[model samples]
Every structure is written in structure tokens, then in C-alpha cells.
Target: MEYVASLAFAKEKDQQDPLNKFREHFYFPQRNGKDAIYLCGNSLGLQPKNVKAAIEQELTDWQQCAVEGYWAAKNPWLYYQQYCSKPLGAILGASQQELTVMNTLTVNLHLMMLSFYRPNKQRFKVLMEAGAFPSDQYAVETQVKFHGFDPESAIIEVSPRPGEHLIRLEDILEIITKESDSLALVLFGGINYYTGQFFDIPAITAAAHKAGAYAGFDLAHVAGNIPVELHNWEVDFAVWCSYKYLNGGPGAVGGAFVHEKHASNRDFVRLGGWWGNEESARFKMEKGFVPKKEAEGWQQSTAQVFNMVSLKASLELFEAAGIGALRSKSEGVTNYLEFLLQQLNGINFQIITPKNCNERGAQLSLLFLDKGKEIHQRMTDAGIIVDWREPGVIRVSPAPLYNSYQDVFHFYEIIANIASNA
Candidate 1:
């Protein structure tokens, strides 16, 4: 797909985009009264215009019905979470009973770990990618300590071979084969936050199961950015935050998936709470806990009605646009950005993201040979919003919902000019 180098080309592409009309649904930020070229959806997504109305409905119910609003609201706050399950399941390619919207990412990780991470004397080790998001690392470390094991001795960190930027499929398989005797779980991020490399989830999951280890994923960066089949992949469990590519506002509710195979396993240990109790008997205030038979059995508290409302608003948009269509546009947008960056050869800038679109989402990590932070600051001053990671990586994500081809073009133009001037 050849692209023309002109504003007219961008306008033409926008005109042809079936999803372009959806951009008007968001409140884009402006700098000095002009719309800023926002490209940092990987960090925090722009708020949807409908979010205000969604939140207002909840407030209205709270004011009108008081305590009765829990069962009397328009959507019925008692059952509000049900509104999220089908749509989210569709987005995740999972069955409705296999998923649920619940606590934040790290909190959900702890809850899932309470049930899945069953370590013993022989099988007491947890395996994970070396450069996973810091929150996941902390969660795993804390879980290991809770189980009376030293993290250094009980946790296995997998890294790419020396001098390599990405992990090879064979290396992961080899580790699983050699360490299966002591490994209890294999936890990994669906996509690496820094390098933007998407791991082969199916292959990894198969290897883990073959070696008698449970598999899970932290999809903070992958959810809504790429297509995932958690149920079909036979992954034992997974958790993800909705704030990133899901466009659910900042710190929104995260979700979890428990394979149906484990849904009826009463022997699996979990931290019990009223919310996870059998829904029919929850209000009875029974002395004993009878856990629900589905994924909702993992919840520890009542739903956050307000945060879930924002998530519902964003999910309605996703339902209309469809993940397949969104991913199609994402590939084209990110590939074009990569092409433009490569055009600036010998400018001391390089893209660390994988070359294959199948192996990455919308983010491209740029490593500047000199003055990375200065260039990032210049781009910010130029009305382009990109996120800077530590050391020397600037992450630019062109979200399919709100970003246009013009956004990518303008971003490249600013970076190219900065490199030349430097």
C-alpha cells in the first residue's frame, strides 16, 4: 500500500475510513485552542463523549432512588455488571461465563493468583518474562513471598538470547521442557510493553500445559489492540486493564478470564468473599461460603457502578466498530508510521518494534542515538503527544478509534525535522 506525501492524501484516507465518524464521539484534548495530535492511547485513552451521560445516569439514580437504586436504576445497578460481560467476551473471543469485569489489574492478578498459583515442594517455581510490566513483577514477587518462598529461588525469569531484541519461540519451548519439573505457572504479557513484541500465546500455552504448568497472561498493552482467543487457546487464566487500548477512561475496571475447565474445580483454592458467593444466596447472609460456578465467583467485592458505566460506553463503540475492523486499520496505520521512520536513514533513530505486524500492536518504540528526551520534548511542544520511557525509547501509538493517517504523518514530520536539526 503506497501512500502519498500530502495533506490531501490524509484527507482522502480519512474520507474513505468507515470508522472515521466515530472520532466525533471522543473529547480530543487541545493545546492553545487547537486540537493536539494525541497519540498516547497506550498510556491513557481519550475520554469518550458519552462517558459524561453514562456517569450522569448513575448519579441520577443515586439521587432519585437512594439505597433502592441498587435494584431500581434504569440498567439495574444490581445487574449492571452483566451488561459488560457479553461485549467484553466478544472482544476477547471468550464465552460469556468464562469472563467478568471486576477489580483493577493488580488486584485481579492477586485474586487469580490465589486460585491458580498452587506451589508445592517439588513444583514451586513461577516463570515469567524478564521485562514484564512492573506491576506484574511486584504481584508475582509478593505472591511468592506469601507462599513462604524466596522470589530469587522460586521465580524464573525468561529473557531473549544475548544480543537479541526479542525472544525466540524455540527458547521459550526449551525453557518449559527443561524446567517443567519445578515450574508451577507460566505468566507472561501478551505484548512486551517496551519492545512491542507480541508473544506466541498458543505455542507457549501448549508448552506450559505439556509440562504440567498452568498458563496466564497480563494483557495491559494487548487488550483491545490485538485479537485474542483466550478460551480457544486453552489458557488457564488471564487479566487485563481497560484503560489502555480499551478506551475506558483512566484507572477503569479491569477484567479476568478463567477457563471453563477450571470453573467447576471445587478443589482449587481461592480467597473467599461475599461477592464471590452464590448470587442466589448472597443476601441470605449464610454462615458458609458457597462459591458461584462461573468466573464471577472470583470477585471479592461489589461492582464499581461509575467506572463500569464509563467502560460500558466505550464498549458500545467497540461493539459497533468490531475488533477485526479496528485491527485491520491498526496494521495499516502502524506500518505506515514504520515506513516513514525508516525513510530517515542514518538520522541516528531506529525502530525497536518487531518488523512483523502480526507480532506488534499500534505502538512503535523509537530509540534515538542521541538526545532522545530533547527530541521527545520538542515533539510535545510541536502539538504531538507521545510517551517517553526510561533510558531512550519514545512510544508512539496511533489508536485506530481516534488517530488519523494525518496524525502519523505530522508526528513523523516533527521527528524527522528534529533529527535533522540536532
Candidate 2:
């Protein structure tokens, strides 16, 4: 596990990487006619090499079949979304019955809350971290307001200790216990986008249950970045975007999860469409809505065949590499990034991400006290494609599927030189 700060060391590791060939599977952004060191997979992933072909195939289908593509296309438009279940379910640790590809991340969260966040006079509050992604914070706030409660009274934000970067697990458990009587739901991000804290979902879910609340997650930064057992953890619901670690192209179709325990609850309130109705009676053009037997019942519209084409291409890489093997490689890449980062001289930045391997994914969020934006700009000019968060944080994520150890070393070199110059 000893890591060295040299190109040779990185090259050696890259040579040994089983996932090295995957780097070729993606088309990285070009910088001076070479691949840029793209560490922003946490934001938007590099496009898969096959994405064009995948999209073209769908375009061809649409052209050739006209209105008949609904059933005549290679992957029938009638049930096109079903194509994702096997590959993606494996990563989610879910049965295909529990998960379904549908709307974007926030849209699915809104839909899930409609069913799960059933608050009463006695229990109407939602509990979550203080700094959840802004969209999630807004969603919970508006949902509470729509139910005729003030957000100030209905939302409880559990905060970190004044000097600490991460929220304590004990603090979360204690708050859930204290607010048990008033908590209608407990929603949290699977990983905080800024700090990259991978939450203890199983523990949090169990605690939420004990506190008599439904537990759910917005897995924008965690899904596909790490292996999560939404089914085994008994997560009531979860949602994720496909463009980040899943390596789907920008604005890709996202997905949702609902536990099997909710499978038979046909009477629950849902905003439905004909696509969600059972397939047998769908074409009958009946007046009443008869929903499907599983999570697919939550679909509000027909599958967006074009939107999912790129996602299907990306999942093929995951299926080929396997999640377990990818996670192992990801740990190595991030740890090496950390090791090399610490070796830089005169750098005044703190890595806010959890140091414990189990508490993080591939991202390392650096809060810089010196030359923050300048350093970020310099890194960008040097062809290191990382992202800078508001205030003074830079997020670096070496995605195992496409990023190589040599890419990590080059990024380190750029930063080290910048620090030394400063």
C-alpha cells in the first residue's frame, strides 16, 4: 500500500491495473491533442466510446420503423427501460422489481416524497444534514410548504460540530431519536457532494425505522461511485442521476428505487400515466388506471428511448468490469491521490473528505486556505479537469473506469509545481 511520488510509480501501477483497458473505452476531452486528466467525474463523466453508436442505433430505429418502432425496434420501445435493470440492479444491490429507470434525479425525489412523506398532525418534520445538495434542500422545503407547514418548523438540519468537516453519526442517531415523535421522513444524500462523505445507509435506515419514520436517499454522488445495497439496507426509496459515475453523457435519464415491501401497496397515492399502467391493459385505452405490480408502476410517462441509449452503453462497461473489482481499483486511485497530495510543499489546503476508506468514494474535496481559485484556474490551464466548489473547495475524483494512475500523477505534479511556485 506504500505509494511513491513519481511517474514511474504511477506507470507501474497503471501497468498492473486490470481496468487499464477501460481508459480506452472512454473519449476523454482533448487538451493540446492529448487526453486531459479528467477528475470531474463527480460532476459529469467522460463519454463512453460506444455512446455515438448507441445513439445512432436508436436514430436508425426511429427512421426505419417510423410509428412501428414502438415494438419493431431492436430494443422495443414498449419496454425499452427494462434493458437497464440487469446491469444497473447488480450495482444497486437490488432486484429488478425494486428499481426502475425513469425521470431525472430531483423529479424522482419529488415523486418519491409524494408517496413516502405522508406526514400527519403529530409527525410532520423531515430530518437531514444541514448542507444537502441545494436541489434536495429546496425539494424538502417546498414539499413541506405544499402540505401547509412552514419549512422552518418542518425541516430539521443536523449540523456538524463547529470545527469539524463531517457530521457525526452519533449526532444523526441522537437527533433522529429526539425528533422521533415528529419525524415523518428522514432523507439524506448517500454522499455529500461537497465533502464526499459516504453515509452509513444501513445504520441510518435502521435508526429512521426505530424513530418511526421512512428513510430514503438522494444518491446523486454515490450511486455507481460505490456499491450500495438499497434492498439489503431496507432503504424505503432512493434516486440517482446517470451522468456522474455511471459515465452516461450529460443530461442522461436517471432512475429510482422502491423497496419490495411497498410492492403490493396499490392504494398508495401516485401521480400516474398510461405507461405506469399494467402492459396487458395499457393498449385497451381504458378510462381507469391499473398500475403495474412493481416499481415500474411509479413511471409517469413512457420511457424516453433516446435519453437512455447512452446510459445503456455506459452500463455495459460496468457489467464488463464488475462493481467489486471497480471499487477495489477506485480505492487505490483515491488513496494514491491523497498520498501524492500530502507530499506537495507549502500547500495550505485541508482534505475535508473522510480519511477512513469505508467512509468515502473516489472524491477528495480540498478546502484551500491559500490561492484557491488561482490554483484551480492554473490546474485547468494545465489541462487538469477538476471542479471548484463555492467558497474554496476543489473536488478531484479519479473514476476507476476511465482514469488511470498516470493521470493522477500528472495532476499531482501540476498541483505540486503550483504550490511550490506560490
Candidate 3:
């Protein structure tokens, strides 16, 4: 598709979009009696309108059924999270038994590390991208320290070479091969949050397996933004939160994936709780832990019904508009944004995100030579919602689910004006 020249052209494209009606299903935040041009789904998605009904159903059930609501409500609060599995599995490309919704993002990461990061005397090292999220870095460091290993000595942080914006795939493969004897696990983000770089997950998984190491991913930024095939990729484990692209709510519950290959491995150590016990035997209050036979075995508490109701509503939307279709549209929207950015010649702005479509999702991380934060503030004052990262990067994500081409064109128009004045 050619770059759109005006806001009217963008509106024409929106009119032709098959998923255009979905925009109405969400609760878009407004400023000055007008809908804000929201382009920050990479940070937090807009709330779905159906979420209220879902929450109300549970509230009504609770009032009428009381204690029986656990097993007797309209949707059965006892098994509320089960409703999430099938749709979530379809989104992540895993079987129902391999995925479950529970816990927060960092908590799930710690749980998976307990089961997957089995460091020993010889192979006592972990490998991860150098610039992973702060929460992930803390989790990994704490896990390393828990195992009596110093973070400086046991963690291998792989970073890009000098003056490069992204890590090279070949360089990562080389590290995996060279450290095969000592590496215990390979953990990485499916999409880097700052630069919006989408890593080669399948290739990285295969490389880790070849080196006799476990492979895992933090899909916080990639879950609803990109297409993933965790089961086909044979990833050992993975975790993600729902607030960003899933639009559940702020600090919403997260999900986890444990490949079926490890499902029956009773010897795999895990941090357990009563909720993880097999449902058939759970009420018996048995002395010993008899865990469930699937990924649900990782659960440590009762389902958070309200938060999960929000997620169920959002997942239904994802099910209606398949992730593959969304990703195809995302590529076009992001590429169009890039095309518009490139037109501002001699404007002292640079795109730090990877140029190749396969290397990114919907976000474009723009670096300004001067006054980056000021430009971001100007866009916000104009009722445009973009995010500013420290040290001079601003991220604009035109979400395929709700953002329109007109929104992008208007943003570029404002940006061009800002540049002219600067």
C-alpha cells in the first residue's frame, strides 16, 4: 500500500477495513469532547465494552448463589479460568493442556524459572538479552541468587555490538553453540519493549535445544500483538501479562505455557499450592500434593474471577478477529507509519526499530537528535497518545484492533509541524 497523503485518505482506508467495526466495541478515552487518537496499545490496550456485562454476570451470580457460586454460578466461578484456556491456547498456538491463566507476569516468570532453570555444578549459567525488562532482570537475578550462584558469574547477558540498534541472530546462535556445555536455560522476550524488535523464537528454541538447554520466553509485549507458535516451536515454557495488548485491565492476571512434553514429569520441581491439586482429589484435603496433569498444575491460588471475566471478554474479541488476520493488518499499519516518518527528510529523527517487517510488531521507536521529550509532550497536548521512554525515544504503536489510518496521518501531520518549529 502506498503512503496516505491526507487524513481523508486514511479514513477511506478505515472504511475499507474488514475489522473496522471492532473500533466501536472498545471504550476509547476522550479528551475535549473528542476521542483521543490512542496509539499506545503496546503499553495498555483500550477496554472492551463487553467487559461490563461479563463482570455483572459474575456479580449477580455471587449475590444469588453465595458460597455455591464457586460451583453453581452461571459460568461456575470454581472453574472460571478454564474458560480462558481454549481461547488462550488458540492465540498462543498451544494445546489446551499446555496453557493456563493465573498469577501476575513476574510471579509466573518466577514459577517457570523454578521448574525450568535447574542449574547444577557444571551447567549453572543462564542466557538472556541484555536489555530485557526491569522486572525480568530482577526475577533472573533473584533466581540465580536463590540457587547460591552470583548474578555476575551465572548470568550471561547477550547484547548488540557497538553502534547497533538490535542484537544479531547469528551472534546469539554462536553464543548458544559456544556455551552449550555450561548454559542451563535461554530466556528472552519475544518482542523487545523499547526497540520493538521481534526475535526469531523458533530458531532460538531450536538452537537452545541443540545445546541441551531449556528455552523460555517473556511474551508480555508480543502476546496479542504478534502471532506465536509456542507448541510448534517446542518452547519449554513461557509467560505473559494481559494488560498491554490483551486489554484486561491494569495489572491484570497473566498466563503461562508449559510444553506437554514436561506435563507428566512429576520430578520437575514447582512451587505448589492447594489450587494446583487435581480437582478430583482436591476437596479431600489429602496430605501429599497430587498435582494436576496439565499446565494448571502451576496454579497457587483460587481464580481471580473478576480479572478473569475481563480477560474472557477480551479473548472473545481476539477469537472473533483471529491473531493472524490482525498481524497482517498490523504490518501494513506499522509500515505506513514508517513510510510517513521517512518523508520528513533532514528533520534529525531516526527510527531505532528494525527496518524489516519480520523483525518487528506494530511499534515504531523514534529517536530524536534533540528535544525528543518536548515533541512527545506536544503530541500529548494535541490529544495524541504516544509513549516517551527515557534518554530520547518515543514509541508510537498503531494497534490493528482499534487505531485508524487517519489517526496515524494526523499524528504525522502534528510531528511534521513540530519539526518545522523546532
Cα RMSD (Å) per model?
1.2, 0.8, 1.1
lDDT of each: 0.88, 0.92, 0.90
Off by over 4 Å in 1: none
Tens-digit lDDT track of model 3 for 344-378: 75468789999999999999999887878888888
Residue pairs that clash (backbone atoms under 3 angstroms), model 2: none
- All candidates in order of TM-score, best leading: 2, 3, 1
How does residue 339 of candidate 1 score in lDDT?
Answer: 78
Error of 2 at 131 (Å): 0.7
Residues 343-373, model 1: lDDT tens digits: 7744676788899999899999987768788
For model 2, residues 1-422, the per-residue Cα lDDT tens digits are 88999999999999999999999899889997888989999999989999899889889999999879999988888888888866889899999988889889999999999999988899999999989999999999999998999899999998899999899999999999999999999999999999999999999999999999999999989878999999999999999999999977788899999898885577767778888898899989989888887889899888998889888999999999999999999999999999999898888999999999999999999999878999999999999999999888999999999999999999998898888888
Clashing pairs in 1: none
TM-score for all models, in order of appearance: 0.98, 0.99, 0.98
Please tell me which model should have the higher TM-score, number 2 or number 3.
2
Q: Is candidate 2 or candidate 3 better by lDDT?
A: 2
Q: Which lDDT value does model 1 have at 316?
A: 92
Error of model 1, residue 144, in angstroms: 1.0
